[model samples]
Target: MDTMLTDIPGMATYLDDIIVMGSTERSFMGSTERSCQVLNRVLEYGFQLREEKCIFMHSTKYIGFISDKNGRRPDHANIEAIQNMPAPTDVPSLRSFMGLTSRCSTFLPGMHQARGPLNELLSKDKPW
Candidate 1:
């Protein structure tokens, strides 16, 4: 990974995602070009590039967050999923949905407070 960093300057790695920061400088003589060159080298060495997953220039998604020079924030997909999830009809379904949304509870203000009802449903005495 250090080799990747040294080779792909301006490229930041967070787990599986690789963020390639862009520059206004000319492509032939800029950090962006150099970054691309390094990426090519890494590809030659057997690393496969998933073009569909790659984001150049603009902000990119990493982990469960969206990141850029400005900073990182929770990804909108997390919000959308929570907002669009169907109202739970049973304990099992509610638990499953809660498990998924819990991953981003930090972004959900007062999530601890909201868990009370869900917890009641999860109690062993509550059957599916």
Candidate 2:
């Protein structure tokens, strides 16, 4: 896929997903057009794009984040995932929960303090 994408100058392709964005109106249209050209090239290579995966200017969430004039923000679905994560049981499970919290910690200020109770359990002197 890297080789296939080498000719496309204005997008980032991860596996089969191609992501493109631009800060200016003109650049944004350029990005879209460049992506279209790349897609055409891909088609010429006898590869097909899945209609479901073919997203345009609109996306509820792209790669778990969103962007626009407001700047980038975490997707609502991502926030809900952490909120809905189940309580952890043992030290390892607690660690996993802590990991999830850390991933979205920016949403909650003083997040380090929130992990204090859990971190205490992972302390070396503390036995599981």
Candidate 3:
């Protein structure tokens, strides 16, 4: 899929999903052109797209984030999930929570400092 769609500008593919982004704010014509190119390429390659799953918007959710002309940010559901996550009671659970938070660390400033105390609890010499 990557080989097939490699040169198309503003197009991204992950597994079976294809995302075409355009700056409708700049020029809706340019956006439409890109979308056409993507569709043509998909048809040329004999790949079928399910129209029911397609979304066309200036800002839309992609994978785990909300993306727009401004850029991507953690989706509200993702943030809420993190906030509602149970406090870790053991090393394994702590690691699990840490792993989840780390994925969103780009959206979280000063995460290292915030997690410093919790991080220390993972140290080998620390008593449980």
Candidate 4:
């Protein structure tokens, strides 16, 4: 992968993911096109990207989050997982849920402000 992709500019790797980034559309397209040509060469050399795993344009899911032209957000898969989860049944379970929520909401906008009420629920004086 190293030698094959070395020719492509603006390519960054985060663990198993490759990030192609640019500050403007024109620049991004140029980088993307160049990367594509290089990737094709790599493909001919025997490596292949999974069809479903490939994403392009202004947004893509990386690790457990989604990054876009605008910025970043929680991964839809993670959100759906949380939404499908059964409701907490006890204090410990509730605390567990709160912990996950806090972690996932770190990059979320207005999290601190909107989470005030939820955060207050964990207070000693509050009823669960």
Candidate 5:
């Protein structure tokens, strides 16, 4: 995976998945062609292309997120999970939410400060 990105030109890998970013002169057909070319090369080298796992357009899913020229961000399913979180009525629930948020806390604004209040919920005498 590391070699696929660092050693190869025009190829990028995220874990087992691959992304072939299009050139400046972008079009759906051009991107699809580029994807096919890359996939062919990959297969020629004995790596199999998982068609079901491949995406070939700007709007296609990548790394569990949809990306385009505009920018990349979390998809609706991730947003829905955040929206549906139960209110942290106690320490255990707060801790669970903290664990989930901690995974992406580096991307979160005011995460350290916001965690101050949440951390208080985990005090020894607090109800679990």
Candidate 6:
């Protein structure tokens, strides 16, 4: 499958799902065209695509984030979960919160600085 789509920019496949993306208006048009090329290639290779699962010209959720030309943001549901999380009262709980936050770190600015104090608590010598 990788070899099949390798020639198309901004195309990615995982298992059987394929996602096409473009980061700007210029590339978005190209992305649309490339999707057609993908469809033709799928036919050429005797693979079938479910039309119901296919989406076009819209920001779509992939992995844990939603992305568009403006770039990716953490999914709102994920953000809400993190926001509603109770403040961590112990090392283990803090670690849990940090782990979740780390998954969205790309959307967070100054993450290292923001987490400095919490990270200190995780140190062996810090004492619970």
- In the range 1-128, model 1's lDDT, one tens digit per residue, is 44565555455665555565644335323655675686676676667777797545556676677766655677888778878889898887888789877878877789999898778888877854
- lDDT comparing candidate 3 with the true structure: 0.82
lDDT of 5 by residue, 1-128 (tens): 54644444455676676665544335433556665776666776667776687555656565446666655556667666666998888777787888777755756789899998788778888654
Worst lDDT run of 10 residues, candidate 4, spans 1-10
Positional deviation of residue 123's Cα in model 6 after best superposition, in angstroms? 2.0
Top-TM-score candidate index: 6
TM-score against truth, every candidate: 0.51, 0.49, 0.59, 0.41, 0.51, 0.60
Q: Could you list the CA RMSD of all candidates, in the order they appear?
A: 6.3, 5.7, 4.2, 7.8, 5.4, 4.7
Considering lDDT, where higher is better, how would the candidates rank from best to worst? 6, 3, 2, 4, 1, 5
RMSD of 5: 5.4
Ranked candidates (TM-score, high to low): 6, 3, 5, 1, 2, 4
Clashes of 6: 0
lDDT minimum window of 10 residues, candidate 2:
54-63
Model 5 reaches what TM-score against the true structure? 0.51
Q: How many residue pairs clash in each candidate?
A: 0, 0, 0, 0, 0, 0
Model 5 bad stretches (over 4 Å)? 2-12, 22-54, 89-92, 103-107, 115-128
- For TM-score, candidate 3 versus 6, the one ahead is 6
Candidate 4 wrongly placed segments (more than 4 Å): 1-60, 104-114, 124-126
The per-model lDDT (C-alpha) reads 0.69, 0.70, 0.82, 0.69, 0.65, 0.82
List the pairs of residues colliding in candidate 3: none
Two-way TM-score contest, 1 vs 5, winner? 5
